[model samples]
Target: MTDRTLYIVVCGAPLASRVGDGVRQARDRGWSPYVIPTDAALPWLEDQDLGGAPVITGNRKLGESRRTPKADAVVVAPLTFNSLNAWANGNATTYPLTTLCAALGSRTPTVAVPFAKHDLAAHPAWLASLAVLRYAGVAVVDPHDGSAVSLEPITSGTGDAVTQAFEWDWALDRL
Candidate 1:
């Protein structure tokens, strides 16, 4: 356990299946990571090895205390288009979204890895949302190469390959 807390926010995308990689990398870097997954991400996490990190899902009970410590940094991997748009629009409808919104509002150091295919990435909102997040100081890394300079959309039918090729160090390095 370490004093630094890293919030790993996962979404429902092929890359989500590798969240364990991120958790392990975070811990190796001296960050006590907490996985916060969107409901849709549950399936992908079914067989993941989180290395004993806690996964926080859904809303907390009224009388329950906060489950995790304050985040020192946040990494949103496999940032699906839906969650990305919702987060950029400040929609805190779900637990994951609420956590993202709060992290953004608090100006927490954040890194987001968007995993949208070419067609979806072509939408006007896609680039706009990236712009919005960048303007807010979030490090937007390209899932393919961890390039913070440019983010290329994943080609159709290449999601699996892209996901497999992604490295957690790409996002963690930025932090």
Candidate 2:
């Protein structure tokens, strides 16, 4: 119901399956939520989801068919380790990542919340990519960084745990 649009990019994480919660939260916060799902996250979203906002897919062309509203800001929630690494290394293989890259290039207000097991975060490439994104002006929210979002490690396959642990609203507020 608001003019301001918040682009929520959902990556392939366990929490991505419940992205609806954050979409609703964004709406409650007076933001028109637009969903951009990474290739790996698409299976979680049903056709009727998102309350009719234009849903962008990863395998698609650069331009979406629908006349989507311009994003006032962006949030990539549950940013998976794979996606983050790809994004940081300038590999915009998916539409979601490509959009995020464009927003960063244009200096849009963008926030990314990485969600992965502790082991993934310990990877050298993952650590380096976090810095790359931060250096490019994205607010990368780390679970151990002692920030607003107190991220906890959710088991890889537990739907309930993933839904409960993900900081959906926290990521939305930053946008």
Candidate 3:
């Protein structure tokens, strides 16, 4: 069996440079890092030099992929607000969501870093969805403190505050 312990899934049009950095960070830490980009994210991945890491398209059977063998944990970085709502409601409309559902179903531990603006992020529905996800055993990292403006260190960067939810060691410990 392979020695991969972490699966990093990316969705949306995130910066290639930032993604490359995150992937490098995961590898430097000794975790076999595999980057899976949803269909929407494929074009972006194709444009970047991923340093030979496999980029699995979301349309395929993700659960059966070689990357899923013994994933100690799954992290969804820069999770879209829509994706967060879908996952919270058990809606697997996309490959990433489906894979997330499968991982959670198999009790493989999952974490999400939702990216959205302050107003959208604070919506009651969003909060409710987060509650449901947390209740159902999915760790939803809150990137904002009470102020709701500044982001926690882990979540701070380009794109959105949601990236904070996928901080490597922080999410790993939860798993």
| Candidate number achieving the greatest lDDT relative to the actual structure | 1
Candidate 3 at 46: error in angstroms? 4.1
lDDT of residue 134 for candidate 3: 69
Which tens-of-lDDT digit does each residue in 1-175 have in candidate 3?
2365767777774532245656666677666767776666666566666666666664756466554456777877656667778777778887677777777777777776655665666667777877786677777553333122233322335444333323445444444
Off by over 4 Å in 1: none
Q: How high is each candidate's TM-score?
A: 0.98, 0.82, 0.72
Predicted structure 1, TM vs. truth:
0.98
RMSD of 2: 3.1
Model 2 lDDT on a 0 to 1 scale:
0.75
Q: Which runs in model 3 stand beyond 4 Å of their true positions?
A: 13-17, 61-68, 142-175
Quick one: ranking by lDDT, best first? Answer: 1, 2, 3
Better of 1 and 3 by TM-score: 1
lDDT of 1 by residue, 100-137 (tens): 99999999999999999988999999999999999999
Estimate the lDDT of model 3: 0.62
Rate residue 108 of model 2 by lDDT: 87
Worst 10 residues of 3 by lDDT: 146-155
